[model samples]
Target chain A: MKLRTAFFLNTNKMKFITLIVIITFNTILHSQSQTGLVQYGHKQSMGMGAPIGIDYNANLIFDNENSLYTFAKDSLEGGHIRESVYIEKDKDNFFVNSKITNKLGFQYYVDKENKKLLSRDIGFNYVKEEIPTINWEISDEKKDIGSFECLKASTEFRGRTYTAWFTTSIPLPYGPWKLQGLPGLILEAYDTNKEIYFYFKSIKYPMDSKIKIQKPNSESENKEWITFSEYKKTLINKHKKAIENGRMLIEGFDSADTAEDKYTMGNSYIEIFDNE
Target chain B: MKKILFILLCSFVSFGFTNERIEPISENESAEITLPVKVETYNFPYENGTITLTIFDNGICEQGTVTGTLSTHCDDDGIADYVWSGTICREHIDALIMQFNASC
Candidate 1:
């Protein structure tokens, strides 16, 4: 009878152990199911890192000696802006290609390969230009960005402020736009609104083929290198006549048959294109 | 044998109670969650229409259908008045607060 009692107690202990093991396993499974699964390359491939719906408002104030001044507010409604970014990396150098679209259906492709930057205006035809090189000062601030550690950096080029955040965690110095020169990958960068904003969307590590840095096309060869300020001046001069024609068309001058009819048009055009 | 059976029954009861009586963790105990969302009210000019949006927290957003006269505003007139209805998730209250602060 004592032996039988001993056997029964041992069986009970075994059953208790089995139940505890099962409970622990169930709890672990439940916790694992609740955890989020992260996709590493999804944002990179879709180019979704660009901040959507960024509203830009600029107030232009003109002051005269007579204290007569006028202020005009220009606001840009937010929309989905698409940018195409391409990156390739080798042992010593990196290549980056970025394309930004404008309202006039023109696309600007800024290519940086082998520490050289080329800016190309891509329309129905390509107008490529070489940009003057500017030196960058690497910063030391560490930023945690979506499972990557990025370092903050800055550069000043021709009255524009260029801030860059790069991550050495990815081992590729390539980033969006012409921003580069880090140990890892660039996450977010901008030139203070006057230029451009290149936000880190994703990083791709290709499995095959070495990255080859391609030279700019022959048409872009031997072009005069200009500062960003000079480029802006040239762009304004090129689009000045077109902007005037657009203003006239928007004013309904083409539809008016008489001068008085045109004169009766309200000052809405003044609010629209007062930048000129 | 009777003692063994009684012990097994007691263990089963204890297990059942532990499973059924487990309490959920309160929101205060959890980490802070911030979601980015936007809501806008628009009144169409010339036409009598209104657009109202309520974005949810889980990113499963819903847009209230637009209704009213289809007129495009050429002048700087006030938007038309229309009614829109939609339910937003409870967790999106923080997102609404952030958006309000940004706009203000």
Candidate 2:
């Protein structure tokens, strides 16, 4: 075909052949999607003293076109931060992770074909926006976790610097929580200060149940979806109200107290940036 | 119902229920919330949520813990919400009030 000139070839026939090839390629890519379930143990530290944090489970079910990160249950008990230490704080204390991700009926869904993300925030606020870009710098460093060889990559999202360990063995971009757009499956991820961390616990790849990608809808949660920025503004207003109310509620939690300066919106949220 | 409310309101006005949030003395960090009355006044730097250490006009001390993010102010709920664990105690009830006022 390259040797022959455009005039020598039948132009109508050539265009038809090209269209067939394009359709075939798209069909092959779509057929190659492997649906599976991944379980991740999430740990978020409440950095008042030593390493004390809340631990919980986040499950991700993904195939080709969509991925949904969901949680089975929520815990308020002082979770194990490391091997021994646990959040001795009252079970009622709202941990940062749950506050950001798992509010009421917290369902995080990603539509890859259209490139959009949908999630729920506190106060029954919904978030549906274009998928934000995560510029990950993959390093040459590699290690073995379980049986698969994992590679290291780092990216700064929201406000915290996160390091992720992914394995191409799975060959999917889905991970625990909101971390996605990777070339492979992210098995583990942690922030720079070790305040937040996620690691692979177990998996049931190629799940038996037919994987159906369903967006969080009114049938489940009766609410209208808003942009991510609007959802954040609501939280900012709540925190500001809390600050104002704090002055009248407790005597010590003021400008001079440790809880005042450190307890800003930036530090309290999983997504540190309010604009997101 | 109105009669009981009137009496309660009158009693509260007469007693001047003063609520404060403070930590216990250095010697009593993990002490039980209910201690013997002879200890005078004690504070609890609540471990998990907001707490209230209230002293009535007659010098009876009572502490209450309420669990909620909104309760952190310890304001309307009369609870103290400071995740920070520090209980600096000034033993005497009257003296604790003076020291608390001076520092704030």
For each candidate in turn, the TM-score is 0.33, 0.60
What class would a CAPRI assessor give candidate 1's docking?
Answer: incorrect
Give candidate 2 regions above 4 Å deviation. A1-33, A46-51, A72-104, A252-259, A274-276, B1-104
Clashes of each: 3, 8
Per-residue lDDT of A33 in model 1 = 35
Q: TM-score of chain A, model 1?
A: 0.41
| lDDT of each candidate versus the true structure | 0.34, 0.55
Model 1, span A56-117: residue lDDT tens: 22111111100000011111213323322223222321112222223322122334332334
Instruction: Pull out the clashing pairs in model 1.
Output: A172-A184, A187-A200, B43-B79
Chain B, per-candidate TM-score: 0.22, 0.17
CA lDDT of B88 in candidate 1? Answer: 31
Q: Tell me the DockQ of each model, to 2 decimals.
A: 0.01, 0.08
lDDT of 2 by residue, B1-104 (tens): 53344334433432332322333456746653433322122244434532333332223323322122212222211112222222222122223222222211
Per-residue lDDT of candidate 2, residues A107-183 (tens digit): 68888888998875445557888887899999999988667799999999977788999999988887777888789
